[model samples]
Target: MSVLRRVGMTLGLPVILLAAWWFASAGSTSFFFPPLSEILDSLVEEWFGPRLAADVWPSLYRLAAGYALAVVVSLALGVLIGTSRTVRALTEPVFEFFRAIPPPVLVPIFILLFGLGDGMKIVVIAFGCMWPILLNTVEGVRAVDEVLSDTGRVYGLRGWSRLRRLVLPSASPQIFAGLRQGLSVAIILMVISELFAAENGLGYAVVQAQRSFAIPETWAGMLMLGLLGFLLSLLFRLVESRQLAWYHGLRRAQRSS
Candidate 1:
């Protein structure tokens, strides 16, 4: 498609929706549903204003820390489980049990153990997000071609060399798929953790605004959240596309045929 057409295709629905919302709520008198323009104005004045750093920075820090920790732990555990039958057999049930549990149900336990601090929230987010990455990696590693494994063994690729040179590359696509899912989960948990107990965060801001009947601020927070989610997803796909460019190319070629 032409650049203009592609842009239109991507933006058409959003534009229509925004226009409809703007027109419909131009003179909104509802306490809960303020005008879109007012919401945008509040978004700019509050989020873009002095309170920005106070609310945003802490949340970002916790999210980054939690996500990074989960990625490392999940990848390590996944590799171990995927490679070792003994470990997999021993731990599969435990992992499944934990993964099956809803994250919110464990919030109280986390809070009691770690208090309403950043550490608890970070751990909660990490716990909530790690399952997808770990499981995906396990499946990916186990699914590697036997022929390729034999070929690598023939070449005497052993230990870390074999894992780095063969296993990780083979499993990267699936690992990344898991990572994408984990990222979405992490975002949700980040917000939820903050909502449950936080001195500051975007989620806390949203909740506080609603409780105080600051309808415009509440809408502003929602807009900020939507924008953040979109931006993060976009950034994630950019990274994934780069890393899996070869996989994407092969798929495209197959489609063309």
Candidate 2:
């Protein structure tokens, strides 16, 4: 399809739904479900200026730091564990135990350890984002075809070179899957972390608005979050498309055959 058509296809449903909401709520007298137009006005007034710096930027910074940290650590540890049956066996129980615990439940402990600052928030976000990526990486590394390993060995690929050229590339599909999952987790954890002991953040803003009975402002904060998540997911898709172009091409070819 053409670019315009594709764009229309993508946006048509949301636009339609938004229009329905706007019309449905046009004459709303309800305090909780205020008119959509009023919410939009509040969204513009609240998020369009100073809050961008004071609230949004800090949240984004924490998300990026935490996500990057998770990705790096998960990939390294995943590769190490995947390469050794002994290590994997030894750590499997511990990994499973930790993974079962909800990340938010540890926020209190994290606050105690790191204080109610950026450090605590970053750790919470990282911890929440780590499991999916680590598990996927381990599985992906372990599932590499033995035929490919033999081929690499015959060509003198060994140790670091083998992992660099063969293992990583082969495992990348799963790695990207984990990264995508981790991104969403990181965003959620960012807000959850900010909800507690926070001076400023999107989540904190929403809480403040609700506490003050500024219903429109609360709705606006939520709208901002949805928009932020949608935009971030789009950006991630663009990156994934570029990174996995070859894999996609191969899949297309296979399917056609």
Model 2 clash pairs are none
lDDT (Cα, tens digit) per residue for candidate 1, span 1-257: 59799679767997999999999999999988989999999989999896589887888888899999999999999999999999999999999999999888899999999999999999999999999999999999999899999999999999999999899999999999999999999989989999886899988999999999998999899888877887888889889999889989999999999
After superposition on all CA atoms, what RMSD does each candidate show versus the true structure?
Answer: 1.5, 1.0
Candidate 1 error regions (>4 Å)? 1-8
Stretches of candidate 2 off by over 4 Å are: none
TM per candidate comes to 0.95, 0.97
State the RMSD for candidate 2. 1.0
lDDT of each: 0.92, 0.93
lDDT of 2 by residue, 183-246 (tens): 9999999999999999988888889999999999899999999989989998998999999999
The lowest-lDDT stretch of 10 consecutive residues in candidate 1 is 50-59
